[model samples]
Target chain A: MDRLKSRHLQIAMFLLPALLFYAVLLVYPVLRTFFLSLHEWNGFAGSKVEYVAFDNFKLVFEDEIFWKSLKNVMVVMLLSIAIQIPAGLFLALLLNGKWKGIRFFKAAFFMPVIMSATSISLLWKFILYPGDGLVDGLLMKMGLEDSIRAWLADPSINLYTVILICCWQGLGVVMIIFLSGLVSIPDAIKEAALIDGANRRQRLWFVTLPLIREAVAINVILLVIGTLKIFDNIYVLTDGGPNHATDVLGTFLYKEAFRNNRFGMASAIAVVMFLLGFVLTLVANRAMRRESLDG
Target chain B: MTNAKVLRSSFMLVILAILITLTACGGNKGNNSSSSASSPAASSASSEAASEAPKEKVTLRIASAYTPDHTFGPAIAQIIDEFTKQHPEVTVEKEFLPVAELDKKLTADRAANNLPEIFIIFPGAGTADYVKEKKIIDLSEYLNADPDWKDGFISGALDNLKFEGFPGIYAAPIGAYSTGFYYNKELFQQAGVEPPKTWDDLLAVIGKLNAAKITPMAIGASESWRSEHLFTALFYKWNGAEKAKGILSRALPYSSPEVIEPLNKMVQLVEAGAFSKNYIANNYAAEIADFNNGKAAMRYSGSWTVGESTGPNSPAGFGDKVGFFPFPYFADKEEHKDSWMGGVSDSFAVSSRAEGHQKDMAIELVKTLTSTASSKLITEMAHDLTAVKADVDPAKSGKLIAEVSKAMSTGKEFSGDISAFEPYKPANTKLYDLTQAVLLKGITPEKAAKQLDDEVAKSK
Candidate 1:
């Protein structure tokens, strides 16, 4: 009993500082947001905060724009997981080599990932701008005038424009993760697959992919969360304009809290977003697990 | 190591990480210049004051969105310098936040219970709210005590900033500005067109410009604010003050003729190719460049553009080519025929947080900055309208800002933006969105107007 007590005491001492910070920073703010969501608050310190129960949540439900934002988030999330993840993995596989320029290509592809979303959005805005943009100008010069697009200004393509920029900026992280996982795979296992007459495609689809289940799962989960919470790209590029057609949950929450001065509504949106992220992560993990097992 | 040892080690590392994070966060908070009054100047000034005579020293932090290059920036600096020189007992620390970041910084500091002792307040909803919360000081007592100061203020200037049914004034008026069509005079001359005398004249000018192959007008709706401001010029011309009041009072729906009429005219402009080609994708940078280089005949812009167009900010000879004109009113209506959209804009408000001697010092700072002398300086340098009546010669103000400033004075009455009015505050953002939808997305004006009315109803 005394030895057991000593072991427990040792554990508590090591954990106390971390627990304190976790509670203060992350846990406390989340709980505070939940509490604030239950009231009607203007977000001003001295302003009267009224207890409105679930009225804020009711307001959120009635917000058509908020729902549109969630739908936009879903579109971006699907693109991120379905398209971006595979694209990243494809790049990782292609670039996983010992060559003079392989490292250079890898570094170049990852360059945007290190830059801020605001700068990336502005750069793309200039490049994608119709009539005057580099892309459109080049197309016009090449007599591909029909290919010209208003890019971020058009309602139909603006959200996708933002999503693609996000993918371009974020591709490096997924690629780097997959590259580390690929490089870590043992030579023996790959040799064994080759000895069994497995070709490059078969080895990739069978042995190499199945081996990196953990990496794919992690990357997918990360992309889903990031896509759902994306704000900076939308803010700098479109600002949820062209008739709120490009609004995402993050921008919606920000508009409510900062611009509209409705903190309660913003908090409710935050909580709903949190739940969506949690459930989606769980679902993604399950799918990845099942797929890995099947492989 | 065994599994338990590894687990224990990782947890210990987590503890160490958390400690470092906590310390870092605390360290960061200590460095929060957001709420700090810059000290060195105040310290040195106070020491100098201490040498002269032992007086009860009161240090006040003054904050503003004005950069030193802004219209009133030099006047503001002069006020602080002169005040400190006169009263050695007072040390005023200045915090200069650019206009874009002022609201965010103010709110953050307000939440922290550490707002600067005096600050420039944006004119609109939040100003009223701040007054109600006692964050802003009531300035009527000071104004009333000094009839010179009271009479010196432009009529309706302070009253324009007052909260409804609230006693006294909460802000001191600094200046006024307007938004209108800033055209290239040389382009108009080359095209053999003068400034439009009426709405039809304006359209004819646009037609002539187009016939001459000069891009008739430049609008960068990609930026959105340009569109909203253009909507401001159109709406205020049609709605005027009384109709605007009626719409806000709910006596008239926004869908009424007053709104849809102007909305339709804007649509007409777009349909006529009066705006730049690919205007939907062209932003401020492109619009300004095209207009400055004479690729376009005109661009709808505001008073601030006058200073930039004529001052060092403009391209070489851009000022020489640029000219401003008020948006034309209805062809038939005699009433409000010369009415233009603009009114008493930016103001300085003392914080209620300051008490006793601190409050007195703050009030003195406001008086010095807004005095007639300071107002004239603001007019001549910044090319803005002074809220205090001052004789500003066109030659002194430069041709462009001077012309607009003259228009601001001669206009029948100053028509303010809908959002700046108290009742329209709740629906301001929705109004901007509605304007964007109507103009950019090609939604029907009637539908957009009704949507705005519905937004107001819902908010109520």
Candidate 2:
């Protein structure tokens, strides 16, 4: 019992710094934000705060712009999960094969992921500009004038344009993770699947995908979190405008908090955002856990 | 522990320590700069007094939200140099922030209770809120004693400097500007259309231009503020002065027939292809470029465009071609035809927390920068249309400024933008979005009007 207590004390000492950090950085701010959300005050407009008791949250729920932003966030999440996952996995599979210049392709594919979001957004904005832009110029040259439209300006395509840019920038991490997972799968398992008369697709499905389940889970969660918190891309590209059609929760929160000076409303939006992320993450984790157990 | 394990643990500890130290040092530097910037006037005054005996040097820090090339920068530097030269015992350290970042930084400073002794106050009903909060010092005491300072300001400039139920001045006007339509004279000539003298004439001109396959106007609606400017312009025209003021002050509903009339008109114009294709995506600079490049016949903008059009780096023919007009009013309403949407005062307020000599110095700085001579110099250099009555050479000042001045003289009343003059509870963002939606085909004028009404009702 004495030995056990000593060991426990040592473990607590080791964990103390992390606990202190979490308390100061995360827990404190969240609690303070909860307190602030109950008051109606512009963050800097003196101390004439009126305690309205959940009015701010009620206002957020009733705001049409808030609902529009949530829809945008959902669209972005679906695009990231549906498009980015398959694209990244395919790239990882291609890179895993032995081929000339494969290493160079791997490095090139990862380059955009390491670049700053602002820089990438700016580059893509220029590329997608309507007139005198690279894409438009190329289309004009090919006598495809009908095909050219102001890609970023069209309400029908603006959100998708932003999603495509985000997917391109984030594909690197997903690719690298899957590549590492693929390498870790024993070559003998693939060989055995092939000998058992499994086709290429069958081998990949039966042997490779099962082995990379943990990597797939990590990639999905990372993509979800990243997409949920997306700000810089949308901010630099559209600024949630052209009629508030491109607004997402992050942009909405920024406008509420900074521009309108409605700190309470911004916090409420943030709290809702957090709850959505938390619930979705739990559901994903459970599904992945069940999948692993079945295998 | 094994040797490898021990070595790895030590490496990890060192890395962690370095990270902590870096973060702490970064945080400390940020805090130091902010504190120094905030309390500059106090520190500068104390150091000046300390150096009166000729024993030590004095240094001052000035936080400015103007870039070095901006007109305010040179004006500020000149004031600081003059003040320091008179004292002979002071030095100023200046820190500048970009214009776009100014409001955010000021908001943060205000929240922290660490505002600079002197700062720019955005002129609007919002300034009233700051006055109510006691963030700004009442300047009536100072202005009353100085006749020269009081008289030098343009007429009606000090009206916005007042707080509720009090006649005392709390801010000073640096300059004045008005928004209006800028049309290409060459385009009008080429299209064989006369310059518009009324709202109907303007619509007729737009119709002619659209028939010729040229967009009548180019506007940047992506930025909500830019879109709001057009709404304000139309509101002033459609609702007339008294009703417009009532609407802005929240005494009238946003969904009133008067408010919806202009939106319906704007939507009709959009359906007729008055604005450039994809106007909602273009930025302010890009829209300006579009008009300058002859792709659009007109742009609605402020007097700031004068400098850009006539500057040395401007595209060829812009200086010779660009012309200005007050956005047309209804010709049928003869009594309101001359009333122009304009205002005096780009204002600044002193922080109330500043006291004694620091406060005195800030007031001195404001007076010096806003003096007639300084104002003239800034106006001429920036190609701005100054509100102050002064003899300026038309040939030297350029045609745009002359045209604006001519209109200003003939104008009967100067009505300010609704959002700028009064506080409506739902905020300007909703109105701005509604206008853009009309322009972008996202909503019909009737639907937009109803939505505005809903927002106004809900907000109350």
C-alpha lDDT of candidate 1 relative to the true structure: 0.78
Task: Please give the lDDT score for candidate 2.
Answer: 0.75
DockQ of each: 0.27, 0.23
Return the lDDT, model 1, position B183. Answer: 90
Can you tell me the CAPRI class of model 2?
incorrect
* lDDT of candidate 1 at residue A205, scale 0 to 100: 89
Per-residue accuracy of model 1 over A112-190 as CA lDDT, tens digit each: 9889888999899888876778889899999998777678887777788888888889999999999988998999999
The top-ranked prediction according to lDDT is: 1
Clashes of each: 0, 0
Alpha carbon deviation, residue B67, candidate 1 (Å): 2.5
lDDT of each residue in B1-460, candidate 2, tens digit only: 5545544565566456546755786687577545434554564576467445443444444455645555455545665678778756446556568655676677788776777767777566767777766667778777888988788778888875676675678888775777788888888887888778787888899999988778899887665666667766777676565666576567677667777777776777677777876676677767877888888998888776776677544697687898888888776665666666677645667776555455555677777767777667666666776545445566666778878777767766666666664464355556767777776778887888777767666554
Reference-based lDDT, residue A108, model 1: 98
